[model samples]
Target: MPSSIPRSAAVSSVVAAALAAGLLAGAGTASAADVRIHDIQGTTRTSPLVGQQVTGVTGIVTGVRTYGSRGFWIQDPQGDDDSATSEGLFVFTSSVPTVAVGDAVRVNGTVTEYVPGGLNSGNQSLTQLSRPTITVQSSGNPVPAPVTIDEESVPDAYAPEGAPAAGGSINGLTLDPETYALDYYESLEGTNVRIGTSRVVGATDPYSELWVTVKPWENRSERGGALYGSYTAQNTGRLQIQSLTPIAQQPFPTANVGDVLADGAEGPLDFNQFGGYTLTARKLGTVVDGGLEREVTEPQHKNELAVATYNVENLDPSDPQEKFDALAKAVVENLSAPDIVALEEIQDDNGAKNDGTVGAEQTLKKFTEAIVAAGGPSYAWRSVDPENNKDGGEPGGNIRQVFLFNPQRVDFIDRPGGDATTATGVVEGAYGRAELTHSPGRIDPANTAWENSRKPLAGEFVFRGRTVFVVANHFGSKGGDESLTSHHQPPNRSSEAKRLLQAQAVNAFVKDVLAVQKQADVIVLGDINDFEFSATTEALTDGGALYPAVKSLPVDERYSYVYQGNSQVLDQILTSPGVHHFEYDSVHINAEFADQNSDHDPQVLRFRP
Candidate 1:
């Protein structure tokens, strides 16, 4: 039976017990003549002296964090010769610390290992001194020099192999700071670190944080961001940066992909819940724009049919009018007003108000009207209302896929009798071609693979007297997957199982259409929520039913999303064998920009059938 409290929770409880044992206000004090900062850190992920009280551990204060887990970090100026043990340690004070930088202080506290997001989260534990008692020995002492992080310092190998007998965990393994990048960072955890002028790989987010790469040449994209091509080649140089100075005192720089952090940053290397290893900077760099610009795809020729996919990041009727207008502008200008646009995450009319309302007429109307207002063609839309709360998204939003088409250029073949739970099938048409039994219908809605997930929407369209079958998908997300920085050597991607099944289901439906008519013009496009090289994509392209069109572009320009500093592919447009040549463009209007309307960059495909 599973324990009532998880192992990490139990560990946390022990730390709490230590804090309550008259140590919070420095009641029990011990001698510091035998112990040092590195001694408490040990040479493993967790402290060897964890849960034990130690006093008179002395160091110079290097950095102080006044808010959000208020604490100050101290470093021994004369560190031990072993590179495996860190010289610096964070002292948790639970409130504003009276200490300042350069103050030599002796601390007494319980050594504890704090796991961020719990052990089940697979994150490495941070060695820290909790419930500390501080004695300022002297003032005006120089803080320890910061270790510089660069290409040479970070190893190409991401992590060391876990101990097999220990259920593939690296927690108990000795630190190899010289061999692996993860171990190298772990050895310097809570230590003063510095990076020279570096290129920004991730755009500054709402939380005043960004990512930069110390290795400028490792898997570098054409736009100055890191490209995540495969699972094995995790870019180990990416380090998240956060300012230690209060935002009120100095505003954090706003940066985009390819921007430069000119003078670089220096501060303590800390680990936290969001990004594993971070440089909480006491001295920050200035932002120099790299001149990266948004891309615009050429409008489709008169004889070509253009189809596009865009995830509007859970658009709703209650969203700000400016957001609606900006998205409309992106659709018209950046996307070049494609003949058919498959939009994902279109919320219901009431937008997150849970009252069993699943209709999106108001939501679609406002969007289509905004497009017209933005100087685009008047568009008609079609979508099946999902069962209330069945689709996985924000609670009460009932987000679903929608197809918007310009009736003047293309026609939506609307077949009656399609509902939320009904599954659509491929059938022989009057002209001996393949057609959907129910136009604007859900595909395999009852499949267990689609449980609590968005079902694919299948629609039949006619462009210039040629019939085309289009399937729009928004597969299960990678929500529960572990981060790349997990202590587990190869981070677990538990979400891919459901996505693989989803892909196989969509692939089976496309194969059915090909079975009826060998020359069926089928196109599958949407936010797949998986990488192009993932097993999910292989399943979707199984037996050659469809070909991912994103592969046709240059390797560096293939991504439609920027995630955690890695430019990657999540949205894709795939075409069947019957559809031969096409032009594909992944418009970069949103993902890489600091100010954006959506989290995804829309993709467009133009072809003559």
Candidate 2:
């Protein structure tokens, strides 16, 4: 049966009321054959005896969760010799159980499988026992020794192929813990597990969780993060770490990328909605500063033009002044005040208060004023205000791409008459140079490819004696994509197709500019919301219309975003052939730190025309 309320506190009240009212009368009290933890958690992802009453299940309590889905985990110390079946299982008590660690207990309950985010979320089911009746057989019994999770323990292969009859799902496959990494973790699903002093690859978030890697050498980035280079190399050693201890009892560590979790951690392995295969630590580790410093790109020379792209993450006038100030400092200090910056996610004034208001003049004014306050240049801005509530973002915020340029360093060419629906075209200009038909205009905004997504914003600028064409983009997000730990092997990226089409549209627009002037200088930059090696990037750079500048850096250093312990590329700067010989830097200020102005790290590109 599908779980109606996964991890919800209401589950406790409902289950308790049912038991108190005899709604499930004698469900767990019936005389039945003894069932070991391994038998309940069979070789597959689901329980074999689901919907049946299981009695005389005996084990020692390893951990107790007092909060959400209040339950206690029990493990059979005398486990079966089979390596595929887990020795432990979670007994959902609904309310906090009186049992403590090391207490040997006999449990009687109904076997059930709980999918964290519901059945349609594509997550694997977590086999567990519910409406448990517990009897403390003894106290002070030793808990099962935790299995070490090291590089030698986990397999290099991610998972085996799904059965042809199962529609590419590995859920029905038998566990091969020795052969596949996913199966290896599944084999110890609810059991006690431990990792050595591991490197903190993903920074700790507000959720009081962080990620660490047991295998330091697996796809290691130069900055010590696990680099997700492709779909195939998933870096199996990465695991999520959360504490079973209450936050009121002890505050979670504030860790950044490259930090060390000293002394390691031991915990009950769990599968959840956010990050699958999480280790809810009963014995958590402390953080040791890794001395990771944020990098600053060198300032542009007098003869060179520096351009940058940053996703301010829904910046609006309603946000705190400190946020605006922090972003201004990042732009001025960390980015060295690039001559031109293509900003994404600049929300309309009065953020998220879904009214008819779609103008962002106040938002831009506040930001530019903050830039000057941070001892930076007086930056002028240009943008086409998107139609109210049409672009996908905060309900009514109407986020769009904007151009911020230092008036002293570059001149924005304004050809009037551009609006929300106007599509910009390229035309031959003075001295056979290419110019935009409407500066700060949307590209193919009416096209279905941009249907609820942000359309590419194109603009014209002149620096020194050369003209440059810049297209700022914020493509469709990966909202519906499955996690790397999905039950479907090689998780399907359903959001990729829309991004690929968006990339094609931008590519075609750049091709139009290049066609008008063979040596046209075009810079397409922003959060494409796809990886540098993804098909979206390939489509953007198809036929050599543009080159992704982020690829010029070392593979380890190409990422501008980090998600779920994997450092990856989502924002990029792609240049036309005429703009060759440029220097690119994915400034690592925000994404690697727990305290950040934005989730995306800004990228800058400098080249001499």
Pull out the clashing pairs in model 2: none
Candidate 2 regions with alpha-carbon error over 4 angstroms: 1-32
Output the lDDT of residue 113, model 2: 67
Clash number for candidate 2: 0
- The alpha-carbon lDDT assigned to residue 278 of candidate 1 equals 90
lDDT by residue for model 2 (1-609), tens: 211123554543443453455322213332346878988887777666666788999999999888666798999999889999999898888777899999999999877666676555677767788888999999998889999999999999988876666667787788999999999999999999999899999998888889999998998888889998998878899999988887899898999989999988998998888888989899988899999988889999999999999999999998999999999999999999999999999999888999878999999999999999999999999999999988999889999999999999999999988999989888887777788889989999998889899989999899997889999999999988887878787677899989989999999999998988887889999999998889999999999999999989988897988888999999999999999789999999988888989999999999987
The ten-residue window of minimal lDDT in model 2 covers 22-31
Top candidate on lDDT is: 1
TM values, all candidates: 0.95, 0.95
